[model samples]
Target: MVMIHIPTHPLVHYPGDILAWIAASLAGWWQHRAFPRETERLAQVTPPGYYVALALGGVVGAWLAGSLNTVPSGLAPSHSIAGALAGAIVGVEGWKWLHGVRGSTGGAFVLPVAVGIMVGRWGCLFAGLADQTYGVPTDLPWGVDLGDGIPRHPVEIYESLSMALFLLAYVPARLRGRAWARDHGFHAFVIVYGAQRFLWEFLKPYPKLIGPFNLFHLICGGLIAYGFVWWRNGGVRADHGAQGSALSVSQPDDEPVRNLP
Candidate 1:
């Protein structure tokens, strides 16, 4: 069994997070231009306050759920992608309901968020056991020594690779004007993420809140359920199917969409 050695330090740990955010921002910019007209249309209906609500919800949920799982295990509190997703959903959906907005407004976020997670988990991998994202000890040939003598499952890489594969399939689907991708891409992302995360949690050493289930497993379950319901209600279009490829970013917008909200 070849063990992978990763040196641990604050610099090693935090830079991955910084890079992840930067990458996510770039991806968002690219995706925004990729579906310009759709962006405008969605924005016109989306509340300006939606972002604010999402931020608030994400922060609160990240802390609450992350700490809920980690602190009980006597580990330092941290944030969770799963919790952030849940928070963003509650915040955005609650805001949408208040403003009478309908349908999947999350289309724009699908790629960027997925990409963010892909990049962010690497930080956890290098952050060593302090990041609390490490998996249990494993004797597998590919196990990693994250500054700890015991080789453990490289779960962070597993998550990052999974999201990367998702982007490969998802990005093409939108460009090809696949209706399922356009309508339900975000929902599908949530479900896929939740399902994958749920499976991955089983390998982690986090204290289980339920019999054989950690806090994240429960959180992932909720996310999967939410994704299903939201997709059925919002992403399902009874009106029409794909006319053609959505407005391509390469083509100029008739008018630059500005301050839509």
Candidate 2:
């Protein structure tokens, strides 16, 4: 079995960091132009300390979850996108609650973050078997040979493609002033991504957290539940104006609302 090996450089070793920086930059640009008031509101509502707290919480949470999930299963404990995402969500929510800030601050991040994940998965795919992100064996024509002789499902590619499809569907709907897409964009992404992740978890070889579900499956379930509850409890209404109306920053003196970020 001739395994495929890609030589690593400094950039390759920190793909996550590079992708995160890109995502942050893109999201900030979107917010600055599309939702300046929202940005200003966040600056006021979310303290400087909250950023530090969120960063620390995200790192610690990712490390802890990754460690727990990998070490217990006899795999080398390493960083995982799932763990980082889950940790960031928890950290931000905790900080929001502590600061009494309500509504989703993640609306602007939906597209950028999705793009980042889709790009980052490429790194996982090329990392080969050592990264532990490889999938189970498969006879499918397009199956990848990740250092193993037997062809295997390219699960990372599957996830990246799924996210790409999601962006295709979501971006158009959001651009067209779709009611649900405009008002509940963040929750919409969460629900869709969570459900997709839940389905894809079955293809992974991670140890089960319950009977057949793994830790990531459980995390996906939690995200789905949170997304549902958040939407059900009128979270969308709080952020947007009228249903079907384009989302815009609040302004004085009755100027025309700008949509498209």
Candidate 3:
């Protein structure tokens, strides 16, 4: 069994970050083109220092989650994508609340985030065991030998594929101008992505924080809950608006539609 070795080169260590930056830029471009008005509104509502807070939160979250998975005895700690995502979400949401911003400004990020993850996972895959992003042992024909003699499930690849499929489905809806898709795109992405993560987490070898579940499982659950609640509330509001419109149409013919002089 040939075990994959961690690259000793400093430049090689940051490929994931580099790819993620590129993905972010692409996501931004797409968001600007697809939802210029919403994007502008978000800029207006975003408070000062929001980006700084998000960066700090991501660092802290990555450290905390990474530590939970594997903490070196004396060496600097590692980070986890899951931790970074959760931290970033918390940071952005906290900022939004402080600024009294309502609804999902995150809709614009869904595509970019998905694309970034799909590209970034390749970095983890190539990082070998040092990245701690590997999956459980597997005998499947498609299993990867990540420098290790043992063929593993390649969970990162699975996650990337899942997100890719989501984007495929989502892009069409956005193009078709579906009301729910336009309004609650972020919520839909979160719910779908959370479900995908929750399932894939089961295949990972991370230590369980609860019975048969790890820290990521809890985070996925929270994401799913947030998405579901927002989706349901949006639906209810739409339904009520439709009913009100119907009621207005049913008004007596004698009654004027407007009060004119």
Candidate 4:
């Protein structure tokens, strides 16, 4: 990897530093997009201030993950993507629990993972092969050579382009109706992405077996299977018998609070 040093003059920031900032900003935007609207109430809760808080949390979480070498050690695109994904997942979910979101709300549970991976993959592409899961050697025109007597496949671009297409498809599907959302919406994206990422892992240079089994392969297959079944079976099954009165939460307390005229 080549590191270019920038003089600390007024106008110049180091390239590495600049890339980090850009990736962080993109990560923030991507993470924010997944916030679901619960009859539009989520908008009131998740404003610019909420996002600012989340971003700061993400930054800290990512730094900690990096220091701990949470996955693998490298300044590659894959690591960047992974870092952003990990941070966003924790940050978004933690924010929801902290805010005391009772019942189900849109966006809080699943969007962060979906959107974060979708956007963070670009960072992987720009960061180059050092962070890639390159494929087996081939004479096919698109193979990349990352030294060590190896010519690998450009699986990074393949995954990115594929996800972009899928995300486009998901947008229209989400806006159609509640039946679409309840039945097959979230699971569709989850299953597809899981399958894609799992298949793409084969092209990577990392170990196929993390422990007793192939972790990437297992997760991909398992999530896809689970998502498919869940979608076909009506997604999350809420226990109506256990549910409490909604009015109690929505209504004012015994002592009346002052309201604007």
lDDT of each: 0.80, 0.69, 0.70, 0.47
TM-score versus the correct structure, for each prediction: 0.89, 0.81, 0.81, 0.53
Q: Give the range where candidate 3 is weakest over 10 consecutive residues by summed lDDT.
A: 242-251
Model 4 spans > 4 angstroms off: 1-39, 45-83, 103-123, 139-141, 146-150, 181-187, 208-261
- 1-261 in candidate 4: lDDT tens per residue? 232221122122234345545654654465455433332444544556456556765576556534443254444322333333335534654665665433223233233445545554544544444433445665665655544344456676677676677757755554553344423544566577777877777766554456433445665666577566644544233323221111111223432111100
Best by lDDT: 1
Find the candidate with the highest TM-score and give its number. 1
Model 1 off-target regions past 4 Å? Answer: 235-261
User: Tens-digit lDDT track for model 3 on 96-134?
Assistant: 567544455566677778888888877777777766777
- Candidate 4: TM-score? 0.53
Candidate 3, pairs of clashing residues: 1-149, 3-147, 4-147
Error of 3 at 211 (Å): 1.0
Q: Comparing 2 and 3 by lDDT, which wins?
A: 3
lDDT of 1: 0.80
For candidate 2, what is the TM-score? Answer: 0.81
Quote the positional error of residue 134 for candidate 1 in Å.
Answer: 0.1
Better of 3 and 4 by TM-score: 3
- After TM-score superposition, what is the CA distance of residue 18 in candidate 1 from its true location, in Å? 1.2
On residues 1-261, what C-alpha lDDT tens digit does candidate 2 reach at each position? 333344433244367557756875785586468656646645644567767766777687777867777899777777766666677788888876775555666666677777877787777777667777778877677777765576777887888898889888877886686766655677777888888888888887888879999988888898888878767764224334543223233345433232222
